[model samples]
Target: MEKRFISLIRFRVAKAQYLNMGLKFKKLLISFFSVFIILASFGLGNYFGKSQCKVCPPEEIDFSLFWEAYHNLQEKFVDKEKLDIQKMIYGAISGMVKSLEDPYTVFLKPEESKRFIEDVTGTFEGVGMEIGIRKGQLQVIAPLEGTPAQRVGLRAGDKILEINGTSTVDMIVEEAVNLIRGPKDTEVTLTILREGWEKPKEFKIVRDIVEVPSLKWEVKRPASGYPDIAYIKLYQFSEKASFDFSKAAIEIMESPCKKIILDLRNNPGGYLEVAQDISGWFLERGEIVVIEDFGGKKEQKIYKAQGPSQFLDYPIVILINAGSASGSEILAGALRDNRGILLIGEKSFGKGSVQELEKLKEGSSLKITVARWLTPKGELIADKGLEPDIEVEMTEEDYEAGRDPQLDKAIEVIKNL
Candidate 1:
């Protein structure tokens, strides 16, 4: 976008320079016509002199694919019972996103849209659960700590079979999330079947305003017992990820610890650069953390550590659950491949696709799936996720008992190392 604006300015300056040059009446007429042509051609960018989406009048919107979607919904869509025109509108919007095949480009109804915008603004209220659909079931990917979901014993691998008696078997993740989350003090009933639980369990949880804690750090004293392990929990690879990670790493280094536990259990990735920057801390001067193969060309990224790796000699036990996705998976995979850390927990979420969000006219945007990222060992973490050196499961009973078997196991593993 910045390059586009600069290019536009350069084009205008060149045109002005051409006008300033004294010319005959005939040349002036030609320049006037040239200026008219250039003004009419409101090009965003040009590749080898070919225009990028030639800007036409607003009347040309009839030919737009969005218009076709609206027409299709009005005429051909079936089911009159509980049929909502707004739902059709939302579906049409979703169609635009799906066309790009970007999984992170989510479509939301009016209320959901509002919530998303609010969340992006860095504040919101609700149970604060990162939800997703897996194997045609509404799954609890992760519940933010201190939120109602986690407070009420919502585990990451728990399959939400029903929400308020309404079966969420085939429901969209967005719809299920909305159904599960509500205002503060509001109660939501969830029927869940945890990974190892034999019987389905039900929980009625009261909602609260969930402020997501982005960072968590704990210094374990007594080198004899826990090896003076420093634990850091990175929830997401968001805008603040790099800064937050640096702060946590620096703080952990301040403590006298021989082992580090980087907990990335339920982190649904945000920005790729965050992953790259964080990985750079552990990786040496020149090492390919991840590579992007986009058909004709392959882009290789060698992340170099800027600061001193304080815990390089120390054993690093990284925790990952089924919810660790995209950026988080990249870091985990990198460390695992490089043999710098031992990965503990279950298989990751496997969303190792890179997305490019293109801003369209108006307030809308188009997020397109650009390329698939591979770990340093050239392993694809897309549909096939990264396997853990130690696979573990969390049960409903374990949650109710106020025990984290995975974290406990990680502590034990580090102790042995």
Candidate 2:
């Protein structure tokens, strides 16, 4: 079996839907063949259909005109050598899917599909920036920690103006991603427009093989006259997240700290299962962690905690910011709703939709948005992100001077608790 990366952010539509789609494709092929035979017998070569073709099915009355135009293009186009049938077929398919206008739903050509497969292997040569469409602009979700994008100070909320001198205006997220990612050690220039900036700034980042760690933890000593606290930052809910979080939890539990701070800032979320597993350590078994709401009266799926409840007695604070999304929001919402934990930071990045990738003909692929995820308390996590219990903004001065008011606020709140 092929190794597929199934993250919280990525899923596939049901197999039944795909099967039904195949049947439709077969029907369309038969319709085209039938039209070709009928036209040939009537000696209507390259003739246009002025009205409904009587021989075609009434249900496909509109499609007969499409076949007429297609045949006309094939016969009358002057650039005979330039007209590649395969490219035309692929372009038609791409155009058909692109009409949906959903950013998450994409048609990956053969080469693009191959690159996607390589990315899922957990090692890819790129600048390591997560990007998405925000307010109709191509926005940087977060620069992965320790990656070239982060090293060059690519901040979250930065709108991408151009990539490698090419304008990113109206560019799809996947198209931008393909442009940004390249062979390791190669440089890619990005022109970005951020808030409070006078104009767009260009940064040339060298790509590298990005390997994101799941979690990092340390016990911070008494700071600002506060007591010691265990600080754990979950980077992303990758496959190894549960094991890494459990190891960190054991270390934190053994330390002399009774208070915990879970930092999910700048965390572009991953697997939902991993989030649920990590939440188990803090929540009681059978507690609702998150809800999967399949729209249109479809039965909702509820994820419950399978817990040992090792940190049940500890005072917990979750630190989140604009980069916190998907699985991160799920965990924070679960903990806050179920365990009364406080989230201290700015609002999160609302990305609750699920995307499933299906392989298409000629090695191409299609990624379609399947469903939207909801929080435990039934809050929509799509466009409306989770609000912090204690909202604290990190100013530009804070970034330049290396100050963290959000983390400080979390510490203060936990100490007072």
Return the top candidate by lDDT.
Answer: 2
In candidate 2, list every pair of residues with a backbone clash: 11-355, 11-356, 12-356
> Where does model 1 exceed 4 Å of error?
1-114, 165-170, 196-201, 221-227, 295-307, 356-367, 395-397
Q: Lowest summed-lDDT stretch of 10 residues in model 1?
A: 44-53
In lDDT terms, how accurate is model 2?
Answer: 0.86
State every prediction's TM-score relative to the real structure: 0.69, 0.82
Show where candidate 2 strays beyond 4 Å.
1-61, 68-72, 75-82, 223-226
lDDT of 2 at 146: 89
Could you give candidate 1's per-residue lDDT for residues 1-417 as a string of tens digits?
999999999999988877676455668799898997786664423332444345644553565676676677667768556458655656767766656544455555556655555566666567777877665566877777677887777777678889999998546565676777677888989898976679998989888887776678888553464568888888887778788878888777777776888999888777777887888777764666777766446655444344344455668889998888878888888777776578888888777776564654444444455678888888888867888888887765776697888888888888888
- Go through the candidates in order and give each one's C-alpha lDDT: 0.74, 0.86
Model 1 TM-score relative to the real fold? 0.69
